[model samples]
Target: MKFLASFLILTMLTITNSITAQNQNTATKTITVTVVNATSDTGKIGFALYTKDNFMRKPIQGKEGKIKNGKSTVVFENVPSGEYAITCYHDKNNNDRMDFSKNRMPLEDYGASNNVMAFAPPTFENAKFLLKDKNLELDIKF
Candidate 1:
């Protein structure tokens, strides 16, 4: 009787663990970001995925995509449900970073997730979007 009870308990635990793992796996989804108005297809478009804590300072993920017909697209996969913001810039010079003029002005075309347009940099609150239970498609224009 003791052996049978232990076996049943172990089996139940195993099944519970398997179900939890499956649930965790299904909780993540994809995010597709498209830049709709790139000035020219001379170079790649650089994309950064940001969370609240790392907004503008560091990115959770970064991707670069080639521009096609004045548009560029990038996909971030397996992103768990949370709040996120996106920033992208057309890297016209292919220098792997956004160029700035002497007076702290951006030289390249750039935009944020919410299409925020301001003199200062975009804030986390202004550009944030919720990623819950579904994949997202966002179009940004510059």
Candidate 2:
């Protein structure tokens, strides 16, 4: 029947559209961060990725990369499009946290996205960058 044929065609079209939308929504890209100028390549590099709500307190994601030839490269994959900030420090002692001096300044080398510096802690807005449906490359220096 013509009615049956039409119904079948419409159903197929709906299913195809749904699949396309899902693929679009799930598309993601990689964020590559290269940390350079490390004081030494003796320890692991600890890094964190932050969003507005989780800045400093909690990282949406965290990673550690081997320090190689006085440099390190970290990657965050499958990242959805949004605003983000990155912070990293050298864990020379392998204790997994940044060291501070008696004056409360950092004792270890550290860097952030945009290489932002502040008298106090830096804000997310100062270092935030947008990631769309494409790969991003960033470099931070210690």
Best by lDDT: 1
Tell me the TM-score of each prediction against the true structure: 0.84, 0.87
Q: Which consecutive 10 residues in model 1 have the weakest lDDT in total? A: 21-30
Per-residue CA lDDT of model 2 for 7-113, tens digit only, reads 99999999999999989878988899989888888888998999999999889889999988888998998888899999998999999899999999988888889
Clash count per candidate: 0, 0
What is the Cα-based lDDT of residue 1 in candidate 2? Answer: 100
The C-alpha RMSD of each candidate to the native structure, in angstroms, is: 3.2, 1.9
Clashing residue pairs found in predicted model 2: none
Model 1's TM-score against the true structure = 0.84
Candidate 1, superposed: residue stretches over 4 Å from native: 1-26
The 10-residue segment with the lowest total lDDT in model 2: 117-126
Whole-model lDDT values for every prediction: 0.93, 0.89
- In candidate 1, position 103 carries an lDDT of 94
